[model samples]
Structure formats: C-alpha cells, structure tokens
Target: MHQVYVLKRPHVDEFLRRMGELFECVLFTASLSKYADPVADLLDKWGAFRARLFRESCVFHRGNYVKDLSRLGRDMNKLVIVDNSPASYIFHPDNAVPIASWFDDMSDRELLDLLPFFERLSKEDDIYTMLQEHKSS
Candidate 1:
C-alpha cells in the first residue's frame, strides 16, 4: 500500500484523553489493522485505548461489517460504542452513541461537544436506557 495522510478530527486528542480517564476505552473500527493501527498510534499518543480491534474482529453481515459486541466478553450494559457508522453497531444498536462523520471541516466541534454527554454516560448504570433517551432527545 502507498503512504497516506490521516487528518485528526478537531479536539479528538482532548476527547480521547478525557474519555480514557473516565472509561476503559477500546478502539474498534471496520478498517484493517495495517492502516488503522498506525493512524491510531499517531492519534492515541496518550494511550487512550486499552485494546484495538480491526476488521477481522467484525462479522460480515448483510453486506456490512458489523461489530459483534457480545464477543468482547465485557458487560454489555456498561459498553457504549461511539461511531459515525450505524452499520458498525448493527448487532448492538442500543449501546451506540451515534456521531456524525467528519470531513475537512476544521471548524467542526462534534467531538468536543460529545464530551458532556459521554461524561454523563460514565455515571450511568444502564447504558441502554440512557442511550435510548439520548436518541429520543
């Protein structure tokens, strides 16, 4: 593969830093590790992620790569996935905290804006109910 440039989303470093302090973070993506790992290494300078899951970790279902949260051996109730792709969490939508995809918008504050919501989530005992309420509002 050729060399590629990965742009960091605005405030992503801060977001990951704060989230790491609050929760046992995991970097899960549909991307292959060969590409995603290096980018993650660059982005996660603070060692935010406890684990990094790549494409092989996902299940190919209905033409989409679905992240099987059940396979993680973690408590489902405490797990929350913050992803821009809904297909990634098709198996466990209730645990998802939907985020918009970032592009070249340097002015975007989506990641920074989600900190408060995630902070509130860190205190919650039931993720399903909180995420459902979050989706509704």
Candidate 2:
C-alpha cells in the first residue's frame, strides 16, 4: 500500500465556488476513488460539485488517462474541460483548456488566474467555439 499527499490547488475553494455559480461543476480526476474521494469531499465541503467522476471514468489510452468529455451525460457543445495536461483532452482538443499542473506549489495561481476567461465562457452559448478561439490565441 502507498500513501499519497493530495494537495488542493491554491484558491481552489474560490474557484470552485465561482464555477458552481456559473456552471454545473463536476469533479473529474484520474485518481482512484479511494484516493480522490476524501480529497474531493474536503475541498468541496461547501458542496460545489454537482457530480464526481474518478479514475474508472477515464480511458487508458496509449499509457495515459484520457478524459473524454462526451461521456459526462451532458451536451458536448456546452462542455469545456480544464485539465492540467493537454494530452488528457486529445480526444476533444477544441473543448480543452490546459491549466498548469500544480504539485503543491503554493504560489501557483493557474486556476485562479483563469477566472476572467472562464467568466467570459460562462456567457458563451457554445463553449466549443470559445475553447477553440482560446486555443488559437
């Protein structure tokens, strides 16, 4: 058995709260349920997330965990995935925003920094087009 240190990203609480206000927030991670659940419960103490998906939800693609947003039971046109790695969203690149990976970096503000952009996206009728524009910019 191995122990893992689950570090909550900085400003994650505020970020999740803000996201919850604008969208139906969901927690999707490649971590195992045993590992990710407690961390998520702690981070989402205010119940920001509407749903949760764990490692089983991801596909083992080419030695990597790939998160296909199409499986979320929601309309793909309205979905955007904020992942730390672009590889995770290779299945649907147009709906991806590659945030910087945070490995216990207290100074990292990637999630917080994205508030303005995400806020704009919240107003967009089609998240796919906005994500595409973001990728090209």
* Per-model TM-score on C-alpha atoms: 0.96, 0.89
Candidate 1: 10-residue stretch with minimal lDDT: 121-130
Q: Once superposed on the true structure, which residue ranges of model 2 sit more than 4 Å away at CA?
A: 1-4
Model 1 clash pairs are none
Number of the top candidate by TM-score?
1
| Model 1 quality (TM-score) | 0.96
List per-prediction Cα lDDT, in the order shown.
0.92, 0.85
- For 105-134, candidate 1 gives per-residue lDDT tens digits of 999999999899889988988778879988
